[model samples]
Target: MIIPAPPAPSTPWPLPRIKLHIEDLDHEGAAIFQGAVNARDALHLAVQASYRWLYTVDNPPPKVTQILLILRSMPGVAHTIGTGRDGMEKEIHFSLEYIVHSKARATAEIMGVLVHETVHCYQHNGKNTCPGGLIEGIADYVRLREGYGPPHWKRRGEGAQWDAGYETTGYFLAWIEDTYGAGTVSKLNHCMKNKSYHKRHFKDLTKCSVKKLWNAYCCLLKDDDGAKVLEILSARDDDD
Candidate 1:
């Protein structure tokens, strides 16, 4: 007897082909991954998170023909790279050793890393001129949106610069979205499409320089008041 599973819910965004490669199936990390999450579903969720956070329906995302997830015995966490000339094909190299080490929170950490790496597969890099911190922050922003942020992640801003990356920039972007309006971050991402990165883009998008934005954001974190944040952003910046 055979029974077909029900189709998954449809999304407005396109889904690329997904492939998985395990360097050592017998590794403990491999066992943890297999037991914790379904590879197909996790990867699909990761792509969906990236699309939802980084793109809009009218403004289509970059074409990603395929995403290959490779699990191997490596150090650190995971990283994604474009293998094709057009940058459509992406490979996410995830460390099995890292997985084994974080076994207690395997599923959450796995999904979080997947979302971050998948965002790299779809996010624009301002024609490769975008700052590295902002790029990593955007990836983490998507992960944060998907509720995969670990408990240890600080919700408030930190560091001397706005682009301190990871949760710092991710939370900053989130704050901008909450304050400016919906789709603010998406507009920021679109501005970088086929264009070089510059601090001016922040002013163009939010009517405030990046430095002012960061300053206001840091103040907001201290005060725990967003209404006050706008007042700081509205003031003109001569130093910008």
Candidate 2:
């Protein structure tokens, strides 16, 4: 059966208030970031991309009132934190050093990181019971869907477990969406919104256990040639 497409919004969702904070202007990475993209536009695009892929007009999540983009010297690429008494405010702390290191692809990399991190601000976490890998997988799924996935990403049938996160699980989720239906991933996200996550959510959505699905996906990779996997991986919503 063909999966129905997600409902499209007649109008764009109202965006959150966006703010920028740079910890060190003199940092070379900061300079690269400033030279690469406009902070407001980048953040706006990232948020919009998250909304476009993960939500529909009929069932949007609660509005994030404010998003503070914080650029600083950090060990990792970026992460998001919730602020405010009600946790309606979010802060995205990005590493300036990583930005400099990825200077050649700074614009796309920065936008990709923003899109990935922005997802954490809005995605439901199964009442905080969801595995961290699945959370990160969903985030990267949005980034991949938005067409910002880096060049180095590849599809591998082995090595790590399915929910190993990042592009690995992102690609697996993408395959599920393609084989089952268009809104499969969206449904998975929604299922986690109100209740604690169970592996059964996978069975609930796809009518198959997560382990079974993973095995099937792995078998598909091994049986098919690279070109076929590429076709499946490249599938995307034209409306997006």
Candidate 3:
């Protein structure tokens, strides 16, 4: 007779179950969605995108119990909210029409937007006091870092300010990461998890003020790309 072995104790599970809801099935966007995305794989990829860029296995993710993706006819591209019967459930709203028009870049663009919205779902907002620009910037920073920057993206030095959000501040944060070191953005995000944003944070991380960084960035753009300058002028004259 073979000896029976004792049952092993369970280990903690990782990641969360992703749920999707599609509203307005008769919409053309729904047809495009059927053509474009494999729902299961897309949500898995989105969760992976969030983890790969934002947190490590060693660092605990935000105890997210479940993520529900709601695809509906919305005014904007996508947004995320924490809606719980209690407080642990999360929902992300994606625009079906946005998906239809983005069929050309279905996989990547959808993943990008999903990742951005997911970041919002996971990242902390400094007790709801974090600047909206920085919040959006952090989302796009993860997107840009994960190589999801869209075709029209260009690093601009004259963005009025560093916290302009989206790709503008994403690029600025990228520059900070490059100039300082890896984990710079991570630390910044982590810092925001506890305390609100202050200008001193930039100085503490990059050893330069944000204003100084913005000034340096604007100076770099003053040197024009000769080819682009001529192309713009030519295009303007053609319109005239």
Candidate 4:
């Protein structure tokens, strides 16, 4: 049954109308999901996480009138889709099966997935031309920033290309923020809002070519003895 969700906690960022639907309320996964987190608050936090990391007051998120969260028995974790042609209404489908499998760490896992999927709700995709890996990397970046990163994942940002996505790209972006200054990633995101994806975007912001940036970032990883990576970057193998 579809239930109209509660109001979001007051915030300055734009918030979409939220909705919830559980395929079978009696399912054990459904019960675990409920016990793990309050549906309303978690959803709100998901939206806010996207804005918190990707946007600022002057350059806000794109308009999203509503977001419908649907929980059901599914194979994968979760994914968000824009149901409206104008991109105003979004639907995030979360898997009940996936939820049940992570029952032991349901709270963090649920929130992580919610935050990851929710980023898809508001992130601009460079007019759908952004690299698939970069899109997923940006989503996981928000997940990582919120401290919802899974324990199984390595903290190191090594052995992968910069756009290898997920934590690899996420940690790289984090390093850019820490090294360059705050809002570096935010500026990168805003540049994508109106133009097609291009490597020059990195240069425009950092005054360095993407190749030099990736190489410099990777060089820092070698000095860490494989212990810390969140502050480092990944190598880029353009040949591959």
Rank list by TM-score: 1, 2, 4, 3
Badly placed stretches (over 4 Å) of model 1 are 1-11, 156-159, 225-228
- TM-score, one value per model: 0.91, 0.89, 0.82, 0.86
TM-score of 4: 0.86
lDDT of each: 0.84, 0.84, 0.73, 0.80
The residue pairs found clashing in candidate 2 are none
Candidate 2 displacement at residue 83 in angstroms? 0.5
After superposition, which runs of candidate 2 have C-alpha atoms over 4 Å from their true positions?
1-8, 225-240
Query: What is the per-residue lDDT of model 3 for residues 150-208, given as tens digits with 9 covering 90 to 100?
Result: 89887877746778889888887877776577667767777666677676677677666
Clashing pairs for predicted structure model 4, backbone only: none
Top-lDDT structure, candidate number = 1
Error of 4 at 147 (Å): 1.1
Give the least accurate 10-residue stretch of model 3, judged by summed lDDT.
1-10
- Name the regions of candidate 4 deviating beyond 4 angstroms: 1-11, 155-158, 225-240
User: lDDT, candidate 1, residue 129?
Assistant: 96
Task: List model 4 lDDT by residue over 61-134, tens digit each.
Answer: 88889999999988988888888778789999999999999999999999999999999988988998888878
Q: Is candidate 2 or candidate 3 better by TM-score?
A: 2
Give the clash count for model 4.
0
Superior candidate under lDDT, 1 versus 4: 1
